[model samples]
Target: MSSNSSIKCTVKKPVEVKISDTKSSLCSGLSIVDLSFPNNSEKGIQQIESISFKNAYTAFLTIKVKSEQNSSSTGGKWKMCLHRYQLMTSPHYESGSQDYFKIPSSQMLFVPQDVVSVRLILQQPSSAWNQFGIEQVSIETPTENTNEEEAISKWLQQHLNLNSTVKKKIENVEVDEVSGGLHRMWALTETVKAQQTSASLGRYEVDDSYEINLLSYT
Candidate 1:
């Protein structure tokens, strides 16, 4: 893939977020946030690249995903991608509160292909804060262009590896002495020009009047 290409999938706006039941007495407790993707035909099937969100006194987080199955008989099922992941170093304190975090591709248990929905189970044991929940949640998926570029890159790398001897021969070829001498001369001229200082006209007067009070010699 190209270095500049992003693997994150473009999440459509108006993401439906459903919050589960919370404790009435406590300010914050266990809660579930479900994110649904209604339209799959627009961008086609996509895999989960990463998950990102801003922390709002959330101590722990659990991630589950649902993906479309190939078989028509069997429908999509929910699978646990991440379980009881610690979001904050200390829930009681404000160490990880209001901090933005991104769960990288490597950390994910399994990359769910054709993912239709995602569930985030948040837990905040501490009641020190007035409100606690995850904020600004985002789901990233690999782009079609990224996948195509990755395939092309892999093919090119394989071909290059197979033709390593040709590359070595090109690198080993010596430069012509005439061209080398010209390059050296150009470099020398440039170096001399850089080192040369502006010549003084020996005149320190502005309007035929000397402005210096003391003579300076170095």
Candidate 2:
């Protein structure tokens, strides 16, 4: 896989997405933000993944982070962990509060303090919101205690199912460079974790065990 440091961050700043006033067809839109910001601020794109349900649409928010060796940064320790932020959709109020689509799990892992990315995926196959638009999206950096591996691990263990035949390994960590010297991000990979890979890299994960959560702020 290719690696690079980027300027991206999870936008803690929340924005509003207007909800439909009347009954609309099932449709989904996509939203994304810069995951790598402040530190190694680089703009990246967020792509859409399949939805969990046929009736429900799905979108994604993404940020880019490189290894410390990839870029330069002063943040230490909790540099690589999940960061938290809120996303507010609904230009108008949905019962006084803007409609919020929550990521089943909050806090994306490994996003640097300053640099993060966010993206949205629209799954309105019914074309109800072919022109869906989010009025505003806000983002900000999380605090020092954002890392919640124990909680996340517990959650994963409870939700994730382990397989006996899956071969997993913890690969060596590689540090890459950001677009500029603005900030640094951490990129980590494990055999247990599943993502797309090239034929040259071998094949996709054979096990269907654990899952991960990620998002970006606007």
Candidate 3:
């Protein structure tokens, strides 16, 4: 009997993907953010084992100490717990910062292939005046590279499943980078109709504008 040693996978270049359309409200108690990509045929959402934040900070939004409130007050006891998780992994809490904080790579844990989500849970203590806040937030993950032609082939096969000739024509189309990072790959010949339809259906249009993080892959 043969035993499988491991499942090896390579982390590729980061690609810009739309996670959310707008910024969320500042939630202090418990906030859950969805990190899945939009559902589309041409897109393959990256499976992340780790992530990092550009800036993460927790501080006192406002501190009001009442004369009546003593050292035993409950306000001084609440603290923020920064946690990240996937479906299979346990919540990894970040520590070591009562003020500005950034998670170092050494402290990061593995995120699963399942959708990644983050939560900021509020921990209350025995004293008073313990409100906390987080801001300047950014989320990131490493992505794998994709072959442009393979993407185009898959898109065309969606429509031309019966017409191999048309599929060949579409595949034969060549493009050159004419200006400012735009690849002139669209064909205006008889294949124009096919191109237009494929585009509207969310076919290929390269969007490589995103920050990349070159961390050691696990």
Predicted candidate 3 versus true structure: per-residue lDDT over 1-218, tens digit per residue: 21111122222222222235368533233322222233311222233323333212221111111111221364423222224322111122234223334342234433222222233322222122233334433333344445687678777678797888887887776654344234234444447776565433323223543323322231
- Candidate 2: list runs displaced more than 4 Å: 1-98, 101-117, 143-218
Instruction: State in Å the error of residue 166, model 3.
Output: 36
Candidate 2 local lDDT, 130-162, one digit each (tens) = 343333333433223434776687666655445
Cα lDDT computed for each candidate against the true fold: 0.70, 0.32, 0.33
lDDT (Cα) of model 1: 0.70
The candidate that achieves the highest lDDT relative to the unseen native structure: 1
The lDDT of model 2 is 0.32
Q: Model 3 — TM-score against the truth?
A: 0.25
A best-first ranking of the candidates according to their TM-score comes to 1, 3, 2
Q: In terms of TM-score, which candidate is stronger, 2 or 3?
A: 3
TM-score of each: 0.53, 0.24, 0.25
For model 1, the stretches where C-alpha displacement exceeds 4 angstroms are 2-28, 41-45, 70-76, 144-218
The TM-score of predicted model 1 comes to 0.53
